[model samples]
Target chain A: EAGVTQFPSHSVIEKGQTVTLRCDPISGHDNLYWYRRVMGKEIKFLLHFVKESKQDESGMPNNRFLAERTGGTYSTLKVQPAELEDSGVYFCASSQVGLFRPTYGYTFGSGTRLTVV
Target chain B: QQQVKQSPQSLIVQKGGISIINCAYENTAFDYFPWYQQFPGKGPALLIAIRPDVSEKKEGRFTISFNKSAKQFSLHIMDSQPGDSATYFCAASIGGKLIFGQGTELSVKP
Candidate 1:
């Protein structure tokens, strides 16, 4: 099976511009998650989607960011008026949903490096 | 906010030696702990994981030691090789959401 896929390995935008990052999770994975890592910080959770519905969006930093997962397949994170602080690597991961299953099944994408200047 | 704390921001070890990275967390509700390895230009890959019920779990050359009371865990790489050089992250999970620690960059010289 193919691993999770993310496009535009790198992106650079002005501080007030908008940028959208896309992620294609592994086939049949219903749990999609978004995480971001600042230059010297740990990776932080951004949100989670269970199929087309968002299971959790508490990790979202602010109102400038929006995430959507349509039809439970692909996910997109849009940062409107990207800020200089938003420069970091945005990661996407997918996993199967089950109460008894371990999280080792979680597969991550290479990530999109977003740089706001 | 919950957080996982990892020590030794970076480390360098000679070949055929043992490399260890430690992490501690304040959240006792976290039931799952996993270690991830990430190379440059690549995403993090699951190296190994352990639950609270077990004190330790080992796979191949990777070992995860968990201390329930201490709320701490560590990853030990036995017979460390150059290929083991990468960024290691320790993460704790609750309800399937992960809280990660500051990564440790390990450099194994051959």
Candidate 2:
């Protein structure tokens, strides 16, 4: 089985620009999560998806950020008119079903570093 | 308000010593507590985790001590090595959503 994979590894965009980050989770993993960590801060949850349906999005910072998982497969996060504060690494994680599943842990991608200059 | 609080933003320990990181949570509903380790430019990986029902769980050199009454938990790294140096984060999970603490940067010297 392959691990979670993230694209570009790093993304740089000017302020107010738009950037879309992609995460391809492990096959058969039904739970996908998105988190971000700004410089000097701990990683924070952004949202979660269960089989293409959003299970929780309370962590979404604002309306400027949108996440989607189509067909219960790979997921994408789009930041429109991104701001300076949005500069950080966006991490995507995937896990098997069941509460406290994947006893080992959720497999996390290397993450896409988004820098809004 | 921050749901979780971790202490000693940074720590240093000699090789073969012990590295302890502490965390406290405010949400009583949080039943799952886990610690993560992240190297530079990498995503965090689970180190050890414990549920409120158990007071402790050990995995090789890593151990997690949980205190449900105090709503606190800690990670203990025994025989610390240079490879153990990284940023450690304590998190509480409720309903599958994880709330992380501020994080602690641990440096194990050779």
Q: Top model by lDDT, which number?
A: 1
Top TM-score model: 1
Candidate 1 residue spans exceeding 4 A from truth: none
DockQ winner: 1
How well is each residue in B1-110 modelled by candidate 2, as lDDT tens digits? 44899988999999999999999988888868888899987888887788889999999999999888888889999999999999999998887778899899999999
Backbone collision count in every prediction? 0, 0
- Where does model 2 exceed 4 Å of error? A102-104
Question: Which DockQ-derived CAPRI band holds candidate 2?
Answer: medium
lDDT of 1 by residue, A1-117 (tens): 999999779999999999999999999999999999999799999999989999999999999999999889999999998999999999999999775246438989999999999
Clashes of 1: 0
Scored by lDDT, model 2 comes in at: 0.90
How well is each residue in A8-104 modelled by candidate 2, as lDDT tens digits?
7999999999999999999988999999988888789999999999999999999999999999999999999899999988999998877854383
